[model samples]
Target chain A: MAGDAGSIPELDQKKYDADEQVKIICLGDSAVGKSKLMERFLMDEYRPQQLSTYALTLYKHTATVGNKTVAVDFWDTAGQERFQSMHPSYYHKAHACIMVFDVQRKITYKNLANWYKELREYRPEVPCCVVANKIDADLKVTQRSFNFGKKQGLPFYFVSAADGTNVVKMFREMIKRAVDYKQNPGDFMDEVMQELENFDLEKKEDNSEADEDGLKAESPDLV
Target chain B: MSFEAKRCGVQFSPPSIVLIYEHKETKTIRKRIIPVRNFSKYSDYSMAAERLKNHPRHRDYLEGVSQSQLEKLHIILRDHMQGFSLERSLASFNLDPDEDLNKLDDEELARKKGQMDELFEKNRRHKDDPDFVYDLEMDFSKTTQEKCSWDEESDDGF
Candidate 1:
C-alpha cells in the first residue's frame, strides 16, 4: 500500500464467514524481534530497517482458521523496565498470548518468566506460546533458549523472522487453536454475565422494597 | 485477599507531583515536597482523569487537600515542570508539521516547534547512516515524550 516493490500480500476477503474475529497479542522485551516476527508473518518479508516502538504497536492480519477466516489483532509491547508497567493492559482481555525471547540474548529468555507470570495472573484462561526468536544465530545460543522453554512446559518454536522461518506456520497453528477453543468459551463468560444480571435484579428489588416501606410510613393506618 | 496483600502501603501508591524550581541566575534546581493525602487523586496526565477519580484512594486524597490548595498545587507543579508542556516536546517527533493539529496553546509552542523541526530534519537525514551516533541521541530525546505517556496513570487508564 505504501508503493513498495515487494509488497505484502493482502488477505482474500471471500474466504471469511460473518462470525466474530479472534484477537491474539504478541508481547516481549524490546529488540526481541517482536516486530520482525510480526512483519514476516503479516507482510511475508522483513526490511533491514529498524524502528523502536515506544509503548505499543498494533497490526491487523487475516488468516484462515478452519472454514472461517479470522482477523487477529496483534499487539506489540515495549519491553524496557519503564514499559513493564504498561504490560498488564496489553495482557488484560487478551484471547491468546505470545511471549517471544531472543535466542542470542539470555536475559530476554529470563524476562519471559515475568511475561508468563503476568499473563497468568491477569488473564488465567488465555492460552500462550513461547517463541525462541532470532534462531539464525549460533546453534549453541538457540539450544540454551530451547532448554529454557522446555523446562517451562511451554509449547516452544524456534524462528528466524529475518529469513522467514517457521513464523507463519506457528501463527497459523495459533489461529487454529484459538478458533477451536472458541467453539465453546464455555460457561466462564456466561456465568459471569448471569451473576452480574442477578445482582442488578436484586438491587432493583431492594430499592422497590425501600420505596414501599417509605410509603407505608407516610400513610400509616390510612387503609 | 489477606490484609497484608491488600494493604495500601505508602510506597505502593502512585508517584507524587515532583516539583523542581530552577533559578536561571544560579542554574540550580530546588525540589519541593507536596503532601498528598489521597494518593489515588494524583493525576499524571489529563487523559486518565476519570480513571484516577474512580481509584479507591481518590476520595480520601481529595479530603486531605482543599479545592484551593489543589489548584495552587497544580499551578506550582505545572510552573515548576516548565508547564509540563507536551506540545513543546512532541513537536520534534511530528514528521509532517503542517498536518499536525497543534493542540497545545503554549506561547512558546511555535518557536519551539520551528527549532525542533529543524533539529529533527537535520537528524533524520543521518539517523539511518551506520556512522551516525550523535544524531541518534536527538532521535532518542524526540521519542521520550511518548515515554511520559506510559507513566503510572496513563498505563492503568488507557
Candidate 2:
C-alpha cells in the first residue's frame, strides 16, 4: 500500500465527465534508458513519436480506469534536450506525473528534489509517483528506502524498464489516482497549487484542441 | 466506401506522417497519424514511403494518396532529422519547372526527381485507367512569356 496518500477531497478542480481523456507527464534527469521503460509499458501497443517543436515525445496508451477504459496520453522527453532544463510548459494541462530516476545513480535520485521544486511551480497538487528506474541492474537497491518520496508524501515504486518489473502495476495505480485527483483535486492533492490560480478549463484554441488530439493544426509547413 | 485526402503533413518532433482525410459518405473529417519507425536522416525515402503505403493497418487509409506524395513527406522528415532548416526543406519542394535537374547536387537532384516522378505519374495514362487513350496527345506550349527575378521578391519560384 502507498499508505493513505489521501482520497478525501479538499479543493474542487476541473471535473471531467466520465471517460474523459487524461494527460500524464513524465520528467526526470537524463540518465538514459527511459525509452526501454516506456516500451515495457506500451509493449507493441505504442509507436513513440519524437516531437520536433520541443524536447518531448508523446505516447498514446489506453488504461482501464474504473469501469470504462479511458485513453491516457503521455507527454515526455528524452535525448540531448534533457541535458538542459526542461521547459516549465511541459506541465501544462497535466493531470498527474510519473517522476522517474535511475536507481543506480545516487545523483539522479538526489536531483529529484530540484525537479520537484520546479514541478511545484506549476503542479503542486497532482498525484506524483516517484519511480526509481533500472532496479534490475541492482536488486539490492529494491530493498532500500528513499526519503525523498516519503518526505514529500508521494507514492514510491522500484521499477525495471528493462525487465518489466513493476512498470505496468505502477502505471495502473497512477492512472486511477490521476482520474480521482482530476475530478476532486481537493484535500487529496497538495494544497499549495490550489491557491495559485483558478483551475481554468479554457477550451481556448491556444493548442487546446490540438492538445486534445495531440495533432498539429493545418498551419505547420508540410512540404 | 471512398476517402479523399484533404491535407498532408509531417510532424518532425516525434516523426510521423499525419494525414487529414474526409470520409466520402458521411463528409466527416478524420486524421490518421502514422508513426515513422527506424528511420534516420540517410534513410531511403522511397523505401520508407512504400513500406508505409503497403502496411496493412495503413494501406486502406492511404489508398487515395499517391506514393510520391508520401515520399515527399519522408524527404521532409529526413531533412528535419538531418538537421536542415525548415526553409531549406520546404524550398526543395517548390521545384522550378524550368530549372535543369542535371546540374543539381545529389540531394537537391533527388528532391527534384521525386517531384518529377509525381508529376509524371499524375499525367501518365495507365492501361487500366477509365479514360486511358491508346495514343495520347497534348499541347503544353506556354501562351505568355513572364519576367522573373532572383526569387527574393516573391514566393512563386517563377
lDDT of 2 by residue, A17-123 (tens): 23477877787765324555566677667697776555567788887776867777777774422443455446655788888877655555555765665555455
Classify candidate 1 by CAPRI docking class. Answer: incorrect
**Candidate 1: misplaced stretches above 4 Å?**
A1-19, A44-54, A78-81, A142-145, A149-152, A186-223, B1-158
* Backbone steric clashes in candidate 2, count: 10
CA deviation > 4 Å runs, candidate 2: A1-19, A80-83, A189-223, B1-158
**Residue A61 in model 2: lDDT:** 86
lDDT of 1 by residue, B8-113 (tens): 1111123344334443456565443333433233444222323333447443333322232233333333333454444443443343323312233332333333
lDDT, each prediction: 0.45, 0.62
- Show pairs that collide, candidate 1: B38-B61
Model 2 CA RMSD to the hidden true structure, in angstroms: 23.3
TM-score of each: 0.42, 0.47
Candidate 2 chain B superposition, TM-score:
0.70
Going through the candidates in order, their DockQ values are 0.01, 0.01
